[model samples]
Target: MKRVIQFATGNVGKHALPLIIERPGLELVGLHAHGPDKVGRDAADICGRSEPTGVIATKDIDALVALGADCVVYTSQAEMRPQQAIEEICRFLRAGTNVVGTSMVWLVAPQHADAWIREPLAAACAEGGTSLYINGVDPGYSGDSLVYTALTLAGRATGITVSEICDYGSYDDAEFTGVSFGFGTTPDHTPIMFAPGVLSSLWGGQVRSLADVLGVTLDEVRESHESWVTPEPIDCTMMSVAPGHVAAVRFAVEGIRDGQPVITMEHVNRLTPITAPDWPYPPDGRLGVHRVVVHGNPGVEINTRLGLDGVDHNDGGVISTAARAVNAIDAVCAAPSGLLSVKDLPAAHADRVMW
Candidate 1:
């Protein structure tokens, strides 16, 4: 069994902690709780399990590293604390601990990373003989891997578009909804997500990865976005939106090669489906869906939806994001020591994973 340690108890962590306990081939060794309330609590308790898993949560990073697990599922909040997260990931790698990450997704293709991330991650892996792989749902499988698989039938591609159509009313993130997304703010209020080079930093790596899969080198990667006004007050699951404020938005990051955009990643996000009447909606007129359009011979277009039995689309996304990393634990632990890309690993699925 692969020994596992989970850092932090957030949305993904809450799902991962208990999941690691139940998966047959994985052993839960420790939980690195981030908040004081979670520290000193039983791992199972932190994730709402009635019985104990014999693992306690601690805020002490060094102590957890000393336990020396086979892998660390690093899912801490990354958008705000990128440097700290990278440092923590390196520390774990240098201690001979492999890492499967849902945080700082740009690492999905370390080649797209700047020297600050790529250099240190490489050094740490070499120093301690470990590996690190980062992935998730939208930026993970749905971004590049799924596209690569779908392109199997293509002869030559003209253009490709991956669209994420999701309603954010049920996504419980106030910081993202209110400020980062400008959900309850005026048009002039630039959401950090829309700031210069922000969206590119987040998904450009995936764009480049897809380009590489298609055997093309990009001329440049560029971004474009537009936000709509609410025109009236509305309340979403996360926060309240005021009239005349930014309500919905559509954005794309394009990877250009040979003076044209060969690959594009787009997102259509609104507080609710009806909020942005002109923007694209899911194929089924639902809240959340991932759609891919491959513009080539024997063209392919498909929509994939993932949701929990009783949970909303947002919660299901969190669970899926966690699953992508957790299920890859054994593969990452078993790979050669280094910063691994999706290109370097085997098909990342667990046996009987659907069960």
Candidate 2:
């Protein structure tokens, strides 16, 4: 069994806690809670597990690393604190611990990572002989590898687009919704998330990854976004929105090749499905919808929906991200040292589950 340490028991990390506990081949060695409120609590209580996992949450990173885990499932919001996250990851690798997570979307393509990051990350791996992987659902698997999966079935593909339409009405992170998304802010001051090059920074890796997988060199990645204000004061799951405040936003990051838009990654986020009536909605008129469209000789479209009768995915996006990280532990632990992406490892099959 591979000994594992779960880092950051936040929105995403909390979902991973139970999955790690459920996996028979993985042993939960340590838990790193993000805040003091969570520290010192039983892992089971933090994740709502009935039975005790016997692991207590700790805020001490050094102490957790000293556990000597085979792999660390990192789920911290690296985009918010990139430098700190990178330093911590290096410490883990240099201590001979592998890592897998969706923290830094840019690192999905290590070759495309910035020089400052690539150099030190390489050094850390060399020192401890460990590997690092960045994986997730949207920026991780859906927009890149999943897109590639559809592209392989196409005959003479011309262009590809991946669109994720999800209602954020129930997302519990107020800071992520109201503050970062500008849900209650005026359009005169657009959200920082839609600022110059921010969209590309968050998702350009997926576009670039697809370009590389297709053997096509991209000229650049372009960004465009639109935000709609609420007609009246409305209350959603995360927070309340005032009249004329931002409620819905549609954005895209397009990959340019040979002076043409070759690959596009788009997101349609809204406080509610009805907020953006003019914009794209769920294909089946549900809560969660992800579409992978390939423009080619015959054309291909793949739609994945959540919040159904039997399976409730309206609030499962974070869990999906966590699941991807947890499932990759073995592949990441066995791989060679240094920065690694999905291309570097073998197919990470789900243990005892269907392919």
TM-score of each: 0.96, 0.95
Regions of candidate 2 where Cα sits further than 4 Å from its true position = 307-312, 353-355
Candidate 2 has its poorest 10 consecutive residues by lDDT at: 346-355
Candidate No. with top TM-score: 1
The clash count of every prediction, one per candidate, is 0, 1
User: Compared with the true structure, what per-residue lDDT tens digits does model 2 show for residues 116-184?
Assistant: 777887888899899988988777777866776787789989999899888888888888645767777
Candidate 1: residue 331 Cα off by (Å): 0.6
Tens-digit lDDT track for model 1 on 1-355? 8899998888788887777888888899988987789888898888888998878888889998998999999998886888898888888899999999888877877888878878988999999999999988878777866787778867877999998898888888876445777777778878898999989988898898788777888899999999988877888787788888877888999998878888999998898776889778887656899888899897998787878476788888888888888888878888899988777878655654755
Top candidate when judged by lDDT against the true structure: 1
Give the RMSD in angstroms, all C-alphas superposed, for model 1. Answer: 1.5
